[model samples]
Structure formats: structure tokens, C-alpha cells
Target chain A: MPIRRLLVANRGEIAVRVLRAARELGIQTVAVHSDADRESLAVKMADMVMPIGPPQAAKSYLNVDALMKAALDSGADAVHPGYGFLSENATFAEKVESAGLIFVGPTPEAIRIMGNKSLARETASKAGVPCVPGSDGVVDSVEQAVESATRIGWPIMIKASAGGGGRGIRVAHDADELRSQMTTAQAEAQAAFGDKSVYLERFIRRARHVEVQVLGDGKNAVHCFERECSLQRRRQKILEEAPSPALSADTRSRLCESAVQLARSVGYRGAGTLEYLYDDVSREFFFIEMNTRIQVEHPITEMITGIDLVREMIRIAGGEPLRFKQSDIVMRGAAIECRINAEDPDRNFMPSPGKVHEVILPGGPGVRVDSMLYPGYTVPPWYDSLLAKLVVHAEDRPTAIARMRRALRELHIEGVKTTRGLHLTLMDDPRFQAAEFDTNALEGWLAARAPAASPTTTTSP
Target chain B: MAHHEVLSPLPGTFYRRPSPDAEVFAKEGAIVKVGDVIGLVEVMKQFSEVQADAAGKIVRFLVENEDAVEPGQPLATIETA
Candidate 1:
């Protein structure tokens, strides 16, 4: 059954992106908003609007009951969870399907299996996908941790099995350090998560964040190459590009094939990304996890592959089979995306949520700006600081970089202090041009430039 | 009663406690020192302490815990020292 009306269960740029795609598919759109987002671009663009709750995300966007009510009341036949929020939530997906509405993503079972790290790792291993060497299960004692660490290698990470957000995680390079950290990790885990179970895994230094985009229609799956998001801060990807400059043709094929294999193993459907940790020196990749929804940096992949991923996902949700086979899709060129956030980079990237005075978006041959910003729009502080994503594509990486530099120059937003200057500076940097950076590189680069800069010194130039 | 209003420094959600399971930083009628943390204003996932500018007794909290606040919005009221 084709979806006639789609309820967008998200906010900000992604919500707008989904609404546009749905409209393109000749589907009417219903945008659900909190009190804070009544005047949001997405709400304005939607065919119908439903007031869910208040400004707090818990009471609004993340409120499953409120969203379902809106969906049913608005007569929406399908719901598009536009990344973040509850996109990867298995229970929410199940609820949507149970309500007799299409969930524009993978099956709930696929989401559940991939949601747990250990379960996903086990599944990947069963499918012959390489995973980071680690303990078979939770380590109960120091002896068990040590035995696993020695087998893993010299530098290993002691992590609380129950902990998240990098808490109760200790990286130790030797046996003595591992022993000392193991006790503390276990205790911290017990105190934090009330679970003393801890695990050990090899710590990869200078690891690159590479992920392959795949589309599946239950029976078959195909990979859309890979994206390199090594330049990150606080594990948040600030900039992204494709195809990975670090991957050789043979390695890229192997990596892409592995992702397809994993997707096929899960009997996946819709759009999903399999995240991998790539070691530049060793030229080895390890499957870390899978995101069972469209990713934030997905536009870069779309730019290179010339596939509207959101459109494809919507088509798949409408019960269509894989439109294009692996042979049908071809990657054309390099693309780069800079996440323009409402943040003051000079002030340690402090969130700058206020009125967007004058908006001058960069647009030319290959530049695309995905944003919800408009003149006189007040960005509410109740959510993520991502204001826009400026993406550019060219014949090659250098040309793409040059196009990005030009696009960034043309881009200008008054009133709010954005990360435009930081992106501009990065564009001129030789290291970034050569793509000689890792996951931790951006934080270090920001720290090195911190001392010379003072608080709230706007770098808008 | 002479009262001074404690304002939120940034526009975001105001939390009276540092964490969910903790007690409110300042209780009503409790004496607090200047620069004492009264609440936390979370803006775009970044938490910053909302400090009491005046040493006095907290008359009452102007906003409930987890309320959406704007810059310069009164968070609490304090009796004069």
C-alpha cells in the first residue's frame, strides 16, 4: 500500500528534508511540533501541523504517545523518523507498525538486534564481518580482564558493559595499568549502572570513522560506497565526505561488500549505515555498529552516488523493492559536507541560539545547503545546535574542497555566531586538505587554537 | 520583604539539581552565599551553573525544575541579606 500522508516525527533540518522528500513522492506531510517549534520551517512547510506538547524534548518529540496520537489524528498513513530522537528505537518502530502505520525504516526486529553492541558484534561475527578483537563476554575478575587484554594486545580499553556515553571507560597500555583500571572500572560500573560487568577490547589509536550506506528491501541489499567522518569532536561528526580518501579501490570494495553482507544477514530493509573503525596504518577495518536509520551525514553519500537516500527509503517503506541493483548505481565524484552549527567557535563552540537576522545561503553549480534557517527565525535552545549543512560536490577531492571553500565564502548568516569561520579556517589548513586526521584530531586542533583565542570573540569573517 | 531575583544566564532548560537523582541545589527559605550554585541552565546540551548573585534566603523558585527558560528569565527569588 502506498503512503498517502506521512507524519514527520522529528524536528530541525532533517524534518524539513523528510517533508520535502515526501512531497516529492506526491505524499502529503504532517509535521508535529512542540510549543517552541510552532513557527519552525518544517511546521510551516508541512501540509498539516499538530501541536504535540511543550518545549522540553521529553514532553514533545520523544513522547511516543503524543507522536502516535498526532499520527493517527492527522490521518497519516506512514511516519518518517528523521534521524536522532527515536529513529533507531525498536519499541517505537514496533508501536508504529502495530498502529497499522508504515514505519519508514527497517523492521523492528532488525533495529532490536543492531541496537545492542554485543548482539550486533555477535551477528557480524556470524556473518564473517571483522570486529574489533575483545573479550568473548563480560569479564568478572581482574584475572579474566588481564587474560583477555593480553590476547587482545598491548593497548586495550576496559569498558563497563552497562555504561555508556564514555563513562567508566579506561584505556590502559600495559598489564599493570590494565589491572589498576579494571578494579576502578568495575567499581565505577557498579556505582553508575548498578552492574559490575565490564568488558575489554583492543584500543585502536588514530582510528578513522568510516561507514558504508546500504539499502535493503528484505530480500536483497546493496552498498552505496562509504563515508569518512574522521574529523569529529565529542564523537559528533562536524564534517563528512565520500568516498573515503584513505581507502584503496580493493579495500573499498571489500569494505562495501562486508557492509552489504551484514545487511543481508539481518534481512534488512530501507536505509542503514554500518559504522566501522579503520586503521590508516594497518589498512584494516572493523565493524563497530549499525545505525538502522538515515544518518546526519547521509547527504554527502547521496551527492556522490546521485541517489536521494530519503526518497529511496520512502519508496522502500511504500513496499517497493530495491529499485537499483549494485551494478546499476555508480559513484560519480567526491563530496564534502560542513555542518554549520549555531555555535561560537572562538568561545569553545558555545551554543548560539537566537534570531537568524539575514540569511544568505551558498548556491551554485554543485553546492547544496540543507538548513531550516530563515531570516527572523529564532532558533530555540531546547535541541541540537545544528543550524545547517553546507554540502559541495566536484570532480575530485581537491575540486570538492575548493568548491566547499567557495561555498563557505558565499555563506553568511547574521545575528547568530556560526561555525562558518572554523570551517573556513579548516578549508585553508593543509592537513585537512590532505585528509591527514583521525577521530581525535579535531579536538586536539581546537585545543591547540584555544589559548590564543578569548571568550565570545566572534570569528565571523 | 526585600527580594532579589536570580536570573538564568542562558536560554534553555533550567534544572534545580545538578543531576536527576540529586536534591535541588537551593531549597526555599535556605540561606545561600553569593556565587552559590542555585540551578543549572542547559543550552544545546551544554550545562552551565546558574549562580546566586546575592547572599540571602531563597524566598521561592520562580520556575519549576526542567522549565524552559530564556536569558535573564527569573529562576528564583531571594530575600535580602
Candidate 2:
């Protein structure tokens, strides 16, 4: 399909990102916003703005009918679901196609297959990709969980088959804990993913979270190398870097190749990320799940490979083949990205949404800030607190870390409390600098350094 | 002593009347009891009625038809009769 006018069925930084890319391609953009985000940056940047609904995400971003109506009403030829919200929703993808608007993503079948962790694992194993040792199907009872755990060995991880973002996952040390954790995991999974299907996997303690970016046009696929996203809190990636410092040349090659193989097997098209849990000690990587949308950490990959992933996705959606072959791809300098959020890390990462009184983005050699914030811009409280992404690229990991620390120090945002101070502290931590950390590193580091008393609380201007 | 505030339970586009030509459900000087349908808010193509939870007189209409409202945003000010 030749996408002329595009309706972005998302909001915040991603919406702004897509609008910019579409505008650069001479594609008219229609931005849909909830009542809370009527005056948001994305709405202001787009050619046309439509009100989807109110502040609640269920009534706005997740409303497939409303999104389709907006696309139809705005005369949009295609709908682009940026990451999060309804981006991975197979039903929404199918509905978009049925509504006659080109869904700028993978087919609904691909989404459905990848949306479920258990099914995805089966698919990966069939494709000869190493999958985490786990059950091949959903575990319905405690007995079933225990059986799977015994087969997979003790210290197994119970995960919601339909879950993501670290939710609906419970690590059990023994049988008793597994029994209790299984029920909790099931309840959480049902509440969060609307699917109570739970599965078991051998938990890799102190494992590094790494992922490879892949682009495909169903028949052809290419890998954009790997990103080390070990820095996480509550199962959400807080910081990510490309050209993972932890991987050797051979490991990196194998990881990328595995990701490409899986993408080709699924007939994957558009931009996707093949996530894996890497055990540094064993030097083994296992496929976790595939995110079938533009990722928040795509900038790091873009910096290292010089590929505009969003542009590639749009081109592929327009039925274009891979513009560059695997041989043409190159991974250069290391790139790091820190998510700047409208939150007070000192206060348990509580959101501090308000107006921006002053804004000064870091600008120096290898420093890049992707944001839509300007002085006097109000941060709405209804959506994710992420305000911007601070990205830096250098010839090596050490240089990239140093550059990120410098950029963070130079960057300043006022009128709301931000995680800037926390990011600065994290950058200065020796463990983080050495990249000798796991997914749990951030939480432990923060808990240890947390103030004896309530940390400095900043109010809105 | 009594206190009352008319509010919306869900987020949507606030509409003052059933239709453009119809009389508004509530207006200045109009008295309403608890559970009275004061207005309608359209969310995702579904129109949900916003009811008055207290017995009062409509003192002021804080929002007009087609106004985008958030959850708990006051749609009208109701003064206890």
C-alpha cells in the first residue's frame, strides 16, 4: 500500500517520533490524543489533530474503534501504532486491516504468534533458536507447575504466557514458594494480559537482558545488531546501549544470526526486537519474546548502525524490500540511551507531571537528546512519565559512558521533578560504568543508596 | 449543611443535551435529585449518561457540549436546594 496520510494511534515521544519521520517523508500525519493530551507536543507537531477520547488509556489509546474512526474521519490511508498501548494487540491489527486502512505493522497472525510467550518459545525452538528451558504449553495447576519446575530444575521462573514488561513473572526458589507464587502469577497474568495462562522456565540468575533489532519484508530480513539493556527496574528497561559491551565478537555474531533466523521463520515484517536473556558465565543466550513494533531503545541501534528504523518500517509497510542487504550493514561506535522521565526516582519513581519552566538539553560531541519538550510545555499526568530520551554515541563503551555522564550533567529540566539526579548517580556508580550488572542491578543499587530520610521532593511550577 | 458537586465518572466528550436541537438535561435554575441524568459523555462512540449524585439545583454549567472532559472533572456545579 502507498501510505499517503498516516494516523498515529499512540501518543508521547513515540507519536512525536513517528510524526517527524512521516513529515520528513512528505506523509501528512494525523495525531490522535486523549483529553489529557489535547495540547501535547505530538498534537502540535502533526498536520491534523483529533480527539480520541479521555484521559484513561482504555477509552483512548486502546480503543480500536475510536482509532479506526479517527483514521477514517481524517482520511488517513494508514495507521501507525507506535510502541506500547495497542501496538502489540493482534485484534487491533486485524481490525485496522479490515477497516481498509493499511496497518503499518506485521500481520495479525504474526502478532498473535509472538504475543504469547509460550507459543513464541515453541516457534523459536522450531526455528533452531535456543529458547529458555521451559514448558511448551500453559501450566494449569500447581502440580503442573511443580512438574515443569522439576523437569526444568529448581529455581525456575513462572511467567504469564501472554505477559510482558516483567509483570506476571514470579521467581520461586522451592516447591512451597512455587505453589503460592503460581496463584499470584496467574491472577496477575489474568488481570494484566487478560490471559491466565502461565508457564515455567529455568531462571537464569544475574542474567543480562540483551535484544537484537530486526527488520523484514516477510521474505527478507536483516539484523541491526544487539543492544545491552541490563539496566532495568521493575522489569522495565531504564537504560540501554548498542554494541553491547558484554558480548565478544563471536557471541555478537551468533546472537544477531539467531535473531535473523527467527524473524525469517515467522515471516516477520516491519521493525521488531528479538529479546533474549544472556547468561554471561555460560556465554549462552536464549530467546525470550519478540516485540513487533518500534522499540523505545531504537535510537541506540540507529546511532550504532546509522539506520533509521522507523523509516525502514514505513518503507517496508509500503511493500518495499530491504534497502540494504546484510553485507551492507555495519555496527560502528557504542551508543547509550537513558530514558528521561517526569518522575522522582528518590520518591519511588512517582510521577511528577507539570509544566516545564526551563529546559536546557545537553549538546556536545556525540550527545543527542530526542525530546519534544520546550520551556512552558506542560507534562500531562495521564500517560507514561517519559519526557525524553538522552542518547550518546562514542567509539567505545568507556567513551560512551563518559559522554552520557557529561551530557546528563549538562542537561537541565525545571518545573518538575525528574530522574535526572538518579541517572547521574547511576552513571557515576562503578558497577554501571564497568557494565558488570544484571537486570536486578538497578533496583538493588537504588535500594542501597536510597536516603535514610525522604529524598528531596520537588514540586510543580 | 450539605455539599454537592456534579462530576463525570468516565472520560469522554461532554455533551449538554441529548441532541443539538433538544433541551439540555440540566440547566441554570433546574432542580435535580440523585441519579438524575444531567448530561451525556461520548467515549469511543459509546454515549454514557452523567448523572447527578446529589439533590441540588444546577448553579453553573462548567463544560459545554463537545468539551473534552477527564475522569472526575466537574461537569456542572450543583448547589444543594
Candidate 3:
């Protein structure tokens, strides 16, 4: 059955993205918001506005009962958990379906199977997807972790089984450090993920972060190719581009095929991403984890493939088979996405949440801004610092970079600090231009550049 | 007595009461023992109790109930013994 009305179970840019897609598909859209987000762009864009609760996400976005109640009261037949929040939450997915509402993502089983890091690695191993050598299962004790580290070789990653978005992890390079870091890692995991159980994985030094986008209808799935997300800080991606800068054609094919294999093995539905850490030295890629929701870097894939992933997820939720098969999907052009966060980059990326007194968005062909910024809008202090995503596409990588530089220069937000200046600096850097940087590139660049940069906040004119 | 500040360890909404139906954990000028839970900071839906690290009397909260707080933001002042 097709969805009559859809409720976007999220806020910010992604919610606006879903509402736009829903409009294009002629579906009525409902926006759920916290009190702080009542004046947000998503609320203004939505066909119907529903208050989930108070300013805190716990009382609002993360409140499953309130969300379901809002969905029911809004007459929405389907709910789209637009990445993060409850997107990969298995119980929330189950609750959505159990309440007779269509959940516009993977099934609860896929989420449950992939949301758990240890279980996900096992599933990938069984599906013939290569994974980082690690403990076979959850490491029970310090002795078990030490044993696994010795066997898997030193420089191991102690990760929380339920960790995602680059939290609940610590890297250890020696036995003594391993023992010391293990306790801290477990405590951090317990505090962050509500799970103290962790597993160990061989840490790759200076690895490139690559991920493949895939769509499924539970029975069949296809890959939309890969994205290179190597320029990250603290394991959180800052910039991403489609058709990995480092992978050869053969390597790309293998990586994408492996992601599709994992998705198919899990009988996945809707849009999901399989993340991998690619060792540029050996040309070997190991499956890291599967993100069972639309990724933040999805626009780059959409720009290159000319596919609307959010729309596809909605269609798949409506019982529609994928319109295009593996053969029909063609990747063209190169797209680059820069995450503009509301942070003072010169101030060690401290959160700079404030009212957006003014906003100037860039335009022109091949440039898109997925954002919810408007004048008088307050970038709430209660949530993630992401202010907007600026994406640019062109015939090739250099052109894409050039376009991104121009687009970034034209974009501006007043009354708050943003990451735009850092992105502009990256665009002009030789290493970034040569695409020779890895996940540690940003941290290194910032360290070297921090001393020379003045304390004054630099805003784009 | 020196005034000691109690700062939030993370960013979130600060709560004066434990819950809606519960009483406020502490009141201004109330004597507090070391390591006593005085309030809570709710971030990402997780409640972390704001404990008084020093024995003191409450000197009023810097933020209102349900107000958003940030890491290192002063929650309250304590008149340390």
C-alpha cells in the first residue's frame, strides 16, 4: 500500500530533505519537532507540524511513545526516521510497524543484526565480506582482550558493541596501554552506549574511510557505488566524495559487491551504508560496520548517480520494487560534500550555537545546500552541531573541488561561528587538492595551522 | 568560607528536580555533604547526577530548571567549608 501521509521522525536538514522528497512524490508530509525547533525550516516546510515534546531530545525526538502518539494523531501512515536518533533503533522500528505504520527503512531484524557491532562483524564474515581481524565475539575480560590483541597483532581497537557515529572506541598499541585503556574504554562504552561489552579489532594505521551505498527491498538489493570519507576528525567524517579517490576500478567493484552481498545476506530493506577502512598501503579494505539508515554523506552518492535515495527509501517502504537494477544504475561525474557545522573551528571546534541573524546560501547548477537555516533561527544548543551540508558536482574531481570552493565561499551565516572557513582552507591546500590525505589529515592540518590563525572568528563575506 | 563552583561535565539540559513528580534535589542555602547528588544533567536522554564534590551550602543555581547547559558551564555555586 502506498503512503497517504508521511511523518518525518527527525529534525534539521534531513527532515527537510525527506519533506522535499515526499512533496515530489505527492505525499503529504508531517514534521515532528521539539519546542526549540518550532521555528526551524523543517517545521515551515512541512505540510503539517506536530509537537513531539519539550526542548530536550529525550522529551522529544528520542521519545518513542510521543513520536508514535504524534504519528497516530497526525494521520500519517508512514514514518521516516531520517538518520540518527531512532533510525537504526530496532525496537523503535518494531514499534512503528506494530502500530500499523510503515517504517521507511530496514526491517527490525536487519537493524538488530547490524546495530550490534560484534554481531554485524559475524554476519559480514558469514556473508564472505572481509572484516578486520578481531575477536570472534565479545571479549569477556581484560585477559581475553589482551589475548585477542596479541593474536590479532598490536594496535587494537576496543569498541562498544552498540557504538555508532564514531563514539565508544579507544585505540591501544601495547599490552600495558591495552590494559589501562581497556578499563577506560569499557567505562566510556558503558556511559555512552549503555553497554560495557566490547570487541577488539586490528587497527589500521593511516587508513582511508570508504563506504558503499546500497538499497534493498528485503528480497533484492543493489549498490549505488562508493564514497571516500577519509578527511575526518576523531573518526567523524568532515568531508566526503563519491567514487573513492584512492580505489582502482577493480577495487571499487569488489568493495561495492561486498557491501551488496552483506545487505542481501541480511535481507535488508531501504537505504543503508556499509562502512570500510581501506588500507591504501596494501589496497585491502575491511568491513567496519553497517549503518542501517541513510547516511549523512548520502547527497554525494545521489548527485553522481542522479538517484534520490530518500525517495527510494520511501518507495521501498510503500512495497515498491527498486525501479533500477544493478546494471541500469550508472555512476557519472564526481560530487563532493562539506559538512558545515556550527562551531568555532579556531576554538578547537567548540560548539557555537546561537541565533542565525542572517544566512546567505550559495546557488547555481551542480551546487546544493541541504540545510534548515533561516534568519532569526536559533541553532539549538541541545543537539548535534551540524548546521548544513554543502554539496557540489562536476565532470571530475578537480572541477568538483573548484565548484565546492566557490559554493563554500558564497555561503555565509551570521551571529554564530561555522566550519566554512576550515573547509575553504582545505580546498586551497595542496594535500587535499592531490587527494593524498587520510582520516588523520584534518587533525594534523589543524594542529599545524592553529598557531598562525588568530583568535578572531573569521566569517565568510 | 571560599565559594566553589559546581560545573556540568557535559552538555545537556539541567534539571533541578530528579523527576517531574519528585522534589528538587537541593534548595538554595541548604547544607550539602561531599558527593551528594544535587541535580541532574540530561544529555542525549541520559541522566548524569550532578554531585557536590565539596561539603557546602547551596548558593543558588546559575541556570533555571530545564535550561540547556554546556560542558564546563557553572551549574551552581557552593560555599565550601
If ranked by TM-score, best first, what sequence of candidates would result? 1, 3, 2
Query: What are the RMSD figures for all models against the true structure?
Result: 3.2, 8.2, 5.1
RMSD of 1: 3.2
- Can you give the TM-score per candidate against the true fold? 0.92, 0.83, 0.87
User: Which candidate leads in TM-score?
Assistant: 1
The DockQ-based CAPRI class assigned to model 1 is acceptable
Strongest candidate by DockQ: 1
Over 4 Å off in model 2, which ranges?
A: A179-193, A451-461, B1-81
Find the 10 residues in a row with the least total lDDT in model 2 chain A: A452-461
Tens digits of lDDT, candidate 3, A1-461: 99989999999999999999999999999999999898889899889999999887878999999999999999999999998788888999999999999999998998888888999999999999999999998987898889889999988888899787667778998999999988888887777677898999998888888999999999999999999999887667899999898999999999999999999998889999998999999999999999999989999999999999999999999999988899989999899999999877776666677779999999998999999899889887778888899999999999999999999989989988999998999899999999898888777888788876533322111
Question: Candidate 1 lDDT (Cα, whole model)?
Answer: 0.90
Q: C-alpha displacement of A89 in model 2, angstroms?
A: 1.0
Worst 10 residues of 1 chain A by lDDT: A452-461
Q: Worst lDDT window (10 residues) for model 3 chain A?
A: A452-461
lDDT of 1 at A318: 96
Residue-wise lDDT of candidate 1 within B1-81, one digit each (tens)? 688998877888889987776688989989999878888888887777888888889999989998888788888999985
Q: What are the DockQ scores of the candidates, in order?
A: 0.39, 0.04, 0.14
